[model samples]
Target: MSSAHYDCTLSLTDFCSKETERVCKLICLITSTGTEMLSPTGFVVLSVALGFIMTFGFVNNFVVLLLFCKFKTLRTPVNMLLLNISISDMLVCVFGTTLSFASSIKGRWLLGRIGCSWYGFVNSCFGIVSLISLVILSYDRYSTLTVCNNNRWPDYRKPLVAVCCSWVYSLIWTVPPLLGWSSYDLEGAGTSCSVSWKVRTAQSHAYIICLFIFCLVHYAASDICM
Candidate 1:
């Protein structure tokens, strides 16, 4: 059999497995897929709820993008970075809302491997870029405060560079998990391929320390600017 990121493993406990699947099936029944026992009432409630989520995401993201684009003065480096970040988040909503709402109602991933791969890939790319943008936003603030800011002529090129580099870095970290370089596990509803180093034991302590050291440099720089 081919290796896959997701597999049907017997749940860690018998009761847990039964209860979880039971709940899932019940949810499906109440919404779109399974036999709806309560007739049209359950169907209506589910549709309304799903619609609310999709609508909210769509409207909110659109407003953010519109406001950012409409106002030119908010085009400062940091604001510009934020504008792109919002665009990424909005893409998360736009590309996904309808399909996600459908899946939630129907209780299955209709998006097959092609869809999953693209969803997984794009989300990973955007998530990292958003986070890195946040981190860089802080750094940019520090740079401005420290009087070492990149010129305000707004090279415009640098932000694009950062965005491109952010996507590249995100892909580098994300692709490996699906490719089976490491064990990927789900912590909750969202898929997380993030490999975090913990300092629980001697072997893992070194990696944790290195992470802290790097963070320390950034923190110290921020303080100096402050």
Candidate 2:
């Protein structure tokens, strides 16, 4: 009822409000840092799916590699290209996909910054390898069907060169991100790492755009040729 008493009461209320606000902000920061973005169900489902894929891929690719090694006749250029693709796929399972499965199951990145960078680098490298392999496969098939109608197979040297080039190209593309041309960082629930396409810088955006175009064109070419 008195002016001094009313003023004191107002100060007390303001203090309580500020304290409450600070507490809420602290709670928010803790949650943001500590909790995963994905729900438990989603995390489990993703983990299971990745596990299945890695298992299936590892088994099949391993078997195929063994078969190629065992059978001399299966070691042709085309088959060798297939083997390279299989090897890349198997590496993806080992280095990239399995780690993803583990992290997804745990619902967080157990790997630190260096691990994240390596994961992104390996995944990107193998992914590019697989794409380039597919493109090479399609080209080989196209040449066989269209040009090699006389039933003569191309020399091993030709496909060998192509395979070598694919590796070089994959390295070329994946290295730029690590070298600061674009960038690699964790993404999607903090469980996986990849090119930081979310970064809005000019170089990063350009790299992302170029990568999208590169992938789209490679896949489209492979699909169309096949």
Best-fitting candidate, measured by TM-score? 2
Query: What's the true lDDT of residue 175 in model 1?
Result: 65
Per-model TM-score versus the true fold = 0.56, 0.81
Q: Tens-digit lDDT track for model 1 on 1-226?
A: 5332221243424323765776545544433321234334554565567578668866886887788779888776667677767777777666654554564455445666456555555655566667766766777777677776465587677777777776676566556546644322221122211232322455345433543454344445654555
Model 2 residue 95 lDDT score = 91
TM-score of 1: 0.56
Give per-residue CA lDDT, model 2, range 10-90, as digits (tens): 334443476566544444543444333777999999898889999999999999999998999998988878988999999
**Candidate 2 worst ten-residue window by lDDT:** 1-10
Model 1 ranges with Cα > 4 A deviation: 1-53, 148-152, 177-226
Let me know the TM-score candidate 2 reaches against the reference structure. Answer: 0.81
**Local accuracy by lDDT, each model:** 0.55, 0.80
> CA lDDT of 222 in candidate 2?
63
At residue 48, give the lDDT of candidate 2: 88
